[model samples]
Target chain A: MERILFGDNQFFAVNHISDEKSRAQAIKFKDDSAIIKVLDDAMAAGINTFMCTTHDRIANICDVIRDNPKKYKDFKIYPCMPYAHKYANAVTELGIVGTLKQYVPGNFFGSLFKGGVAYINKDFISIMELLVDAEMKMFKGINTPVIFLQNVITDLLLGLGMNELLIAFAKHVESKYNAEAGFITMNLPKLLSVLEEGGIKNPIICASINKVNFRMSGGKELYEEVLKQGRCRVIAMQVLGGGAIPPKEALEYVANLPNVESILFGASSKQNIQNTVETIKYHDNQRVLVE
Target chain B: MLKVALIGAGKMGISHLSILGAHPDVEIVGVCDTSKIVSDVLEKYSGFSCYTDYLKMVDTTKPDAVFVAVPTKFHYKMVKDLLDRNIHVFSEKPFCLNPTESNELFLLAKKKGLVNQVGYHNKFVGTFQEVKKLVKEGFIGEPQHFLGEAYGPVVIKKKSETWRSDPNEGGGCLMDYASHVIDLINDILSPINSCKGAMLKSIYSKQVDDAVYALVGIESGTTGVISVNWSDETYRKMSTSVTIIGSKGKIVSDANELKVYFKSDEHPKGYSKGWNVKYVTDLTEEVNFYLRGEEYSSQIDYFVKAVQGEVPNTVNTFESAWKTDLSISIIKNNSK
Candidate 1:
């Protein structure tokens, strides 16, 4: 996780508060060119890591990056898994078998006939591997140093007591993609313990760590306690509480946290992006000076 | 009696509230919604405790079952939390927004020995059930091909959006409308084996598709096509139809009627099968308070029965919905 990592929520029109804002964003970033312009602005502001969902549009972004490798050489994507809506839409149109065939790489028929059967036979680990591979397909030859399990899957698995799969994910991402496995969850304290119990040490976890406990499941105090005592690298997201918390207070609150090594935020405009990055940098520098 | 609580105040949630509030076997414990106005109205009408937070509702009411009528994106987390608390869940469909989460929930429900149902109400629709029975009886004699179509007047213009129009939340017409058709296909025909030639178009919203078309092949060697348009205002009301063709006969079913056409008089005893039409009302049992449709109440009744251990949790179980989720996943990924 990199400090001041750029997020794709703005590109994808994910507004937590207002549908009007989301619709506006959808219209503004309807084209990949518009999305690229914002990414370019973020890069120009010296932010390199791009944390994004594995949305279909991201494939276009990856293509542009891959085509002009020199220009975006330092750019990186933290690929998030199970972009739930994408898979949901795919399943509706393709059927599960058809969806798996389309997503699982290599021979479509072979994977459909063989791997699909295995996945149904409860070889879920293999299915997980196939999905990871499918999600990472668009980021081929790009710098995706951290592949994430989206909160939709992460918190579900957390709630299901299926933390072992998280360990398997960590191992698979490390061994296969040679990237760190980042788990984004609403409940960071519980996830950290589960990951630790599953034998993953110092796991990279992205969570909502805000002053108002906006989306933080266990609340701010518990998260701060875990951050102080836990052996995980925390990437604080939703730090602005989806705009519930002011940027200055939110940045200062998270920047002073013990194990928060990164801050992830999304903004459509160049000025908002610059302000956030600068705010985080200023707070981080101030914390260093105080220490 | 099963103590049931509802977790959403959307259209589907209100429907559930109506049924649960009136059903004899159910004791409405609590209902949670983000909208205070919706909660207040439901609370006033139903005399049930209302909360804006689901966790609070669950902890306080301690219902044995929860009806999750929340948005598609919230399905995974909300259902998982209830399932973790060992509470049975009746979730609105698109079981989850994706297969991975659906699979996880399916397995978790099984592991917890809790009854789980997805809101594929068409499975309980009388004509559709009759269609399933006819297919099972081989009235169509070797099912070969099928078609499912849904056209509606909604999403016809540039309107204010909601989660339903967001691809990250609601998967446009593909997830919201076509999903029901796909689930109906799974119920009436063999599970869809593969899908191709998908066209997802956004006429109203840039993020969510308003029209979707796909070709699907079933496990029983039946080829199928699904076409849905939420923006089609040509119809006075929402219209859905399913047509199944086989070697001996063909069945055409719409919202109102089920028509069977057989090559000869070799059909079930009720029909000479040259062509026969049966209104859906004739096939459906008369219900006392059927708002929305009989399928809505019927599905809820089925779920309550399943939860009461009186029947097998057969209709739209997580295992079955996972297949539907996978099919949707295929269509969406292919359309890309």
Candidate 2:
């Protein structure tokens, strides 16, 4: 695992700051080549891991990567699954029955009946497993070291007290995919405790971490306490606080933290990619010297 | 025509066989291998005679030269027998398992006035060749420090029943993989003078080391470090690179391209002071070999030209590889 991982938020226009900027990004990166160009720029700048969503266009990206095995051999993708927008759109356009028929694997008619029965019985775990398998079908042959449950589902599960589903997701990801399950949550401190209760020890948790308490739900102090005391592995995302903190200060703060294993970020331009990577490395070296 | 015989049907031996068999001015007289299947296949396709015993093949074919691509453990004995018959020889690198044997073979070749070369084919890579050219041209003036790295997924798991995993036969990453980088560095810069520290770690194989790290000083007062790992699965292919720092500028190179960064404007024409990247495709000769890049064929062509007495053996000579073996000796001794 690299200390720096490039995120795919910019490609899908998931800008946290403003919807206007998000729409602009969505328009800017409407093409698959645009996404690949930025990823190549990140690779040239020495970042190897792409912590990304399972967006439909990303399947095209995976096609490019699979075709040129020599160029992207070392490049790994940490797929954040269940791109919520995709599912929502599919359900709206096709209806519930049609969506289930289209997405579910195995005998289509059999799956429809099974899905109907499961929905009637409120068997959300079976539905969740089927959806996970559906989401994972895109990255069939690629190297995905960490399979992340998107924060939407993670925080939803956390709010519902459905901790056992997290355990099942982790176990399925391990047994079938042979990858460690990662959870992205707004409430890291609570999620850590719940995940521990569910038997996922030393879970890899990706959360918003910044200097000014940007998205640090349950506050920043509690997050820090859990990071210091808990057994969870931390990957700090939104270190810039949705463009609130200065890049240098935000990176310096996160790079000097105690238990953050990696920093995940998104940038559109080559210069920005190079600058951010250099800044992180520079600050990391400074921290090493000071300590 | 120069008559050549090949001994061994392993990976490198196949590379040499294809190049030699395809040469216009060369005739592959025989190919000798321990496996009858391998020998029969070569003979069927190449129309070259095949034999199980190398000595018998040499006696019958009476080849003008021999390409010894066997394992390192057999290089000394096989090459010594061929050289005793006053035949030109091209053997693979780490000339032998022992430096003493390498020195003896080198001297014997010189005494016999026979053309002798080692298979440090990296020297023929277009980017590496350009790096050497820039160094000799004083582009990176007065080398200060150099870093050589070679990493790949050659032995990530415990591999047994192969000579490569045996320390006495293959010498693990230090000998099998790092030798190429050491040979390249020695070719580009000054010879190593002393080793400060060295570590050989066995990650998967119990009998041999899979990783090597060393800090050394060259005779020109330049510090150098080399790190090699044969267990890195992150690489889709083997990654070997060299970065050299100097007072005026620096040259960073790999198999694909060369990046030159100059501090001041004293570089050759078409190159500026700041930075320039040149890919091997732009500098490499047209590829003629079947399995590999132009460098593989280029090395064989150089050897064929050397054997024909048209050009002196300047690259990958026994003497040069003997020097690399001396550095390997120092590294292995220091690590222990």
Candidate 3:
């Protein structure tokens, strides 16, 4: 896991605080060139990992990156699955049957439709695999070291107390994609316990770990308890607590944590990327010196 | 444990079921849905008794409480039936298609002395809750005006005939998006008394208003703006925010964060006079089980506690949700 991972929220217009900023992002990232430019900027700033959702527009971004394989050689993309909003938006625009037709891995639909229907209609595991395969189609040939189940599905499955599905997701991602499955969740303590109980040792989990405990379900104390146990590889995201904490403070808090091997941040400019990378490097160096 | 049965297996239904299944006070005995495949999957995996007929499931399970997550049109009949059976009910919001019927349900729930609630989850959001707290504590003293706005990408293109696009089914920006903002405003500041210059614009949908804009009179003797649009593609998801400007200072809050400005250096409520920014994490207490957000689980937990007599059947009761429905009705009538 890279110490700093870039996120695709800025490109996809996902500002949590300001609608104005999100609208501006929607306008700014209208071109694939602009997105490519930012990726290049992150790479230039010595950050190589891009953690992103499998939104349809991301395919275009992947196409540009694939075209310039030489430039993006060391760059890694962590693709998150089941881009929930695309299906939701599609249902609104194309209706259910049409949306299914649009997304059901079109060419292989003929071959896999029977197994898929049985899985969804009668049982469940194969249906998840189909969705993953459909979502992972866009990132073909890219060095996707980790595939993430987005928090929306992850937390729901966690709450359902269905640990087998979580285990299945990890196993499926490993078996099919040759990538480690990273579960992005709001509840880190509970998810880590469930994964471990399900016999998934040292699973890769990304969650909100911040100074102010933003989005860290079960709160700061429970997160600290789990992280100290060192049972799982934790990727600390929303380190700024959804832009609440200052960068220095947020990075310092995360850099000093036990199991946080990575820090994920989304920024639009070259300077911001450089600043985040430099600040993280500084805090990490400071922590190493103290330890 | 309190025996509970779910009446719908839609998206919201499944969410509530998961939370309830994990709830310490809850024992989910029956899972009812109209879909065969959904019921089959749930029955196989979750091991809950699944049924196609909700009435049969209710009769067999004998649940102390029922969570109704069906669409708006069926909400009235199903919730009414459940209430008549002397069962506690928690229905998903836009409580009823008609405000008068909603009021009647409120009265019935009160008369029956049943613990009832509506799924207005924003009230459970910590940032919004912080806003309500600050308003009540006079941190922003005597709020003079407010701007309640909600935007989302629901109907960006003209395509389908889902319940969301049907006016009769309580679908549109007014019912789907604006109702949330109106409910938050009704609780956070003051209940909306009247609506003026309401404009329901159909940017995409033919039968439903895709955007709603109006000046609403609050019970606090001030007018505020209610601006909501479901056709905005810029927002990644539904975003609701409220801005309250008062005599002492101001407050602007969304689901994620809260920012307040104070005019005096008094440091009321341990907040600085100039400006204080508080994230949802600061306001939200830890929940036993967490899902998409703390609010979703917390709202259900509050209802469960209320049902168990550990807490009062206050926040987001049938009365408040009916008020939100009335506000929606007011906006719709004036938009005409």
Candidate 4:
């Protein structure tokens, strides 16, 4: 039986962390608190698995795990590293020039600079070198399984040309770093087709259902296609469309999707977490309309 | 009580037909188009009779209100003929091939006291409306600079020696597409000082430019950049985004979405992220508001209301003429 995992995807806003200093603080403050609450709430609700992205947030999450290893002894926390190489130059430039204020605040720049210290002053090529360096450092001492979450939006915008660099990066991380690397995408058919074309040997590809209009088409197709792939497990996120979906429907849809190994959701408050648990238990066996 | 006839059974005509078909106060008595196939299809779909000759259709139908969805080149003659028959007109964009012809239509409409409206749907998009509201509310402080871009790959694949491809036939991205954004710029900015742009044939090798880029300077000292291009893919690449940078904050409305960001003193703990983004959903509200009608069942509603003296014609002939003039000037200067 594929286990249903519950966690919030809400960390520091990925786009908001414009600079390294703010990114580091956000890592220490916002992301740290959000992950702790998400994991604590999931454990209380009998959910053993928690999934999140690997941005600056992961550093703080790893710190928390190291500090309170006993509290998370029984829980499995999966941190997916976001593919940041595409805009690494832009992000790093914003950090150094301090013009990050044009887009966001000063703290955001500080966090990004601190979190991205190794690549803060590096050029585009050197940024890539740092990404490989960070990947190596992350794999060296980490005993827990690290699932690097590869996002496609940056790839599409940065002209990485989709699936080519993505597959190569996944293969490198898996083979070179010996980490469990998988492709996560909003486009299921394209991702699966690319994986097949690239001959990706990784066994755990996941997909997320994002956007309100796409909730029906993308969400349903992703649920079924992941099962069909069989080699890869599915991780579903954005269950609420950033709090747009009706609460009851959100829980039921996540619980009922066949072959879904885990569902990641974000909560702004304690009640939001409790309410999700209640909504999931409300319709235990009865099939409900997938929102 | 006014009877209405629709010319051109294309997308806009059918949309108007559906609205007029449902209005309790109006009667969509007839429809006309050059293509018997198109007329027959729309006639069957709308359950109305279709005619080939517009003059004959108008005479036979005796429509008090006529919606002209014909090509821009035909707008001058068709509108002139309709107004000569004392019929009010609701025509689609590119009111005329040039400003002079558009001015003639305006004068003719005025002489006949006929209600006239040109289609500029982007002005009615909810996000733009909200941005206008934010500008009024000083949410983004004093609006200083405005930039807009509207680009799309041309949808009509088979370009014949059609008028749209001919500069004389209102065939350019500026007139066909940029008019919406231009109208929006006029609506938001007061006292237009000067409008200048470069119209280039960047993408296609046709007679007319496939892309146009222009700079509009409002009398308010707010400079704006406008870009219109026809190099978009099969999907609609039309994006009407406006960013007004003010001293206090900024207000932006992309036709795809709308948002206004400003620095707040209160700074609620969580709200520190930035200005919250809100999606606008109601298109009808703005349409009806501009039409000065309680409800807009069809574009015909505005035409009928203007004809019956129920509301002042929101889009007068002068505005249409000005839009045409501005479009022609921008295209002529930019086509380097």
Candidate 5:
């Protein structure tokens, strides 16, 4: 029986904390106490895989692990760095001014000019360059096997004007970063396509099993397609439709999927963690019929 | 093996005719409709006798069961007449105009011991069954709340105000559209203790609301909200989703998609994520069940089963009366 590897993404925040300042503050606070607590709890349940976003969060978490390295000697942490540079043009074009213009339209150009040249410096383009530089610097000698998480493909399809561009960006990342990193997070279709491009021998694709618009095909059809392609490994997440399914059933449903290496579950509370452990244990005992 | 007569050579009626025609144990003996052209077309397509008058057809064919797929207004008289002739009757939804009429039919069916069934196809849908299983397993902890929304715009001809558009003819979004949601709620959330709903006249400004919304409280104190409309321009979108927010976890059944998210004690994370597809096999099992007649196959099957004494009238006249009565009461309360 293959072991069911478990992990939670973004462990510190109670809710979906996306703001850079708050996220930075969360990890750096008190030597990253919040992340340590989550990691310690996870390790105790025989789940040692840790995934985090951004270099600061990873550094803070690593610092905590190093404080008592022997305590987490057996644990492994996988950091996810954002590939924000890929959408540099789109992000840079609509900076603070564009965002402001959306809410309060009409004299955005006047407001921009009045705000001075410093406002233009804060555009998405400048920010993207800065972020890419920071990321490149962060990636150097980052010998740890990291997984890069990308944004939703649907958004890219509608917003980016071309699917080929998205595909090219993914391919570029794989070729450039394959030696240093482990795999890229993506859906089943994108994962197979990326594998066909052939830079990374093994790319990890994170597929969601939830009620989202991206799932145009049936669950069975999607699963069958992935299995037939047999290209790229996959991590199944969102089995329960983002807290929509009951925990037990969600676990069972996910555990039943074919060729799933690990499942990423979101735990907001301590009790949820305990329940998840129990559910995994129960699933481990049952025979999963993978056709 | 029982012989069945189908009335109303419409889309739904034709579906029944084809299905029944293929059933080894059941035979479609006759088909009746107001339009002679439609009746002839259906009869030729289905290889069954055609009739201009349903009464004459029923008397001649002497079918063991009669399937009423005509308009809701015609259901009362047709079903009543069928029951009087000691023939079992199965009718499409909106059993009658009001609960009183539905109850009257129910009493008659009961006295005659005729098998009766209403078409609530969602009850037999596979996704709903899966959600039910998850709920029973305590997946979403103790389900405290549920919310559902279903909307779509099916083309309706202008100036031809069909029975579905007229409130008196059992035509309206609430009756024609929201009826499925109501039945779905009943199937998934058993024993709804009390329901307090509001029917808004949002979109269509004619006889009834083109959009309808409702809030129901189940016996277990679990609250549910349902929103339905026929105003969406999208092609035939029917989403009957139920979100069960429980004490321990949450379960969302967004149509065929089921998702569960819960907190775990272990902090496991990695980007070495791969996509694995999980096929919902139970759906196929449900389709087989309905096709096999092990589960009720709409009203016609129920009528046949009732006549054969294989199963007691599970959906008797009273149940229809009660459902319609509840619907009317809900509508009346909303009007007030």
Candidate 6:
């Protein structure tokens, strides 16, 4: 994982601070070239990894990256599964059976027969694997080092006490794609314990970690306690607490934390991206000197 | 731990079950759903008492509170039954189908002195909470006009019929999507007392309206417009936003952030005369068990606290939901 990974929330109009800004972004990035331009900006700031959801628009972005193989030789994408809306739109257009046929890949009847078997035998793991294959279609032939389960499904599974599914996802991703399976959740502490119980050691987890505990379930103390124990490798996100915390203070807090191998952030402008990278580096340097 | 039971195991019901399962102060006494498959799986995996019959679940569990997440047609009868049993209840939004039924339930809950809530979770969003506070404090002095909108790709093309495709059972965009906006406008500004005109357009659905455009009048002597569309493919999910303009300045907010501009030097603390922006993460309060968003868990937490009498029933109460239901009815009538 890169120390600093560029995110895709801004391109998808997922601003956490301002609806006006989100609308503005929806207009600004209406074209795929605009998204590529921002990627270029992040690269210019010496950032190469793009951590993003599997939105349909990302397929087009992937096409651009695949076309310019020379320019993006070191560029990588960490694709998160079940971009939710894609499947939702599919389910709306086609019924449940139609949805499976649409995304299951391979011969339509063959996949249907497999899904039927999975459903009859109550073998959800097989269905989950097939879905991962479906979501991976867009990222074919790309440098995807890690595939993630979005928090929507991750936390739901956590609440349902479905640790087996998480473990299955980890094993399948590693075996099939030769990539580490990452989990994103709001409740980091609980997820960590569950993953550990299932024998998935030092899982790569991304969660909201900041000075104020914004979106951090189980609170800041529990997060600090887990990080102290070094139970897992964490990718700290929402470090600015959705723009609530000041940049310097937020990054300093995360940068000094233990086992936080990476910081994920999203910014539309090059100046904002550069300033963030600089602040993170400054705080990291200060931590090293203090040590 | 408070004794709690869940009735209905649909998508929303499962989410509620998940959050409640992890709640420290909640004990899952029973779960009721008509589907044997749902109840059996939940019973096996979660180790909770599950029943295919609602009446049997209630009689056996005798829960202190019950979360009613069944379809719309079942809400009034089931919620009324739970309230009659003196059990606190939380029903999913679009409170009840008609104003009369919702009004009766609201009054009954109020008269019986039983705790009641509806699941309009947007109220728990931090930016919207900030928007509520600013509006209450007259951040935009002397409210003049406002606009509420929600758009997504729900019914972009024709598909098989479900509860959502029926106006009576689904309530279409006017209930499923617009009710959130109506509830927000009523909660943030003032109760929507009247609606002048409404247009229920069926861009895709055969029986129900896909888009709702309405002119509404509120109790604060202000009128506003509501525009909601479920067929808009530009958005990935349902996105709601509100803009309010007043004599002093203006305010615009969404689930993500709140933006305000004041004309004079009378700015709120940490805000300036010019445009000021606040993010949801800045204002969100932490919860014990989080699923999708902080708001989802926050809403349930508030309900649990309310059940314990630790907090008053002020937000998302049965009364507030009734007002929204009445607004939906008014829109339907005016559109006709």
Give one digit per residue, the lDDT tens place, for model 3 in B1-336: 999999987778988998897788899989888766567667766787999888898999999999998778888888888989999999998899988889999999999999899999999988888889888988778889999999888887777677788888878888878999999999988788798779999998989889999999988788999999989876788889999999889998888778899999754656897888876766777687777677889989999999899999999999999999998888888987
Cα lDDT tens digits for candidate 6, B7-33: 987778888989998888999899998
Considering the true interface contacts (CA pairs under 8 Å between chains A and B), give the fraction that model 6 also has: 0.56
lDDT of 2 at A78: 96
- Report the TM-score of chain B alone for all candidates: 0.97, 0.97, 0.98, 0.83, 0.81, 0.98
Clash pairs of candidate 2?
A: none
A126-146 per-residue lDDT for model 6 (tens digits) = 667888988898999899999
User: TM-score for all predictions?
Assistant: 0.54, 0.56, 0.92, 0.53, 0.49, 0.91
TM-score of 2: 0.56
Chain B fold agreement for model 3, TM-score = 0.98
Interface RMSD of each: 19.3, 28.0, 3.1, 21.4, 21.9, 3.1
- The digit string of per-residue lDDT tens for model 5 on B22-103 reads 3446877788877643453344323468897989999999998888887788888999999999987778876787777787
Error of 3 at B220 (Å): 4.0
**Which order, best to worst by TM-score?**
3, 6, 2, 1, 4, 5
The sequence of per-residue lDDT tens digits that candidate 1 reaches over residues B267-296 is 897888588876554566533333345677
Here the TM-score of candidate 4's chain B is 0.83
Across residues A157-250, which tens digit of lDDT does each residue of candidate 3 receive? 8776667788888999999989999999888887888898988889999998999877776679989988998888988888887777888888
**Alpha-carbon lDDT, every model:** 0.80, 0.81, 0.85, 0.58, 0.55, 0.86
**Each candidate's root-mean-square deviation in Å?**
20.5, 22.5, 2.9, 18.1, 18.5, 3.0
TM-score of 1: 0.54
Residue-wise C-alpha lDDT for candidate 2, range B204-306, written one tens digit per residue: 9788888999999877778989999988865434678899998889898887767899998889887999998776645666433222456777788898999
CA shift at A106, candidate 4, in angstroms? 64
Model with the higher TM-score, candidate 3 or 5 = 3
TM-score of chain A of each: 0.92, 0.92, 0.92, 0.64, 0.62, 0.92
Can you write out model 4's per-residue Cα lDDT over A90-199, one digit (the tens) per residue?
33223213323333323543565567544333232233334555544432334435455554332231111234445546656656656666555544544555567777
Best by TM-score: 3
> Would you give me the overall lDDT of model 3?
0.85
* DockQ, every prediction: 0.01, 0.01, 0.45, 0.02, 0.01, 0.45
For model 5 chain B, where is the 10-residue window of minimal lDDT? B286-295
Model 6 DockQ vs. reference:
0.45
For candidate 5, the iRMS in Å is 21.9
Q: Which candidate order results from sorting by lDDT in descending order?
A: 6, 3, 2, 1, 4, 5
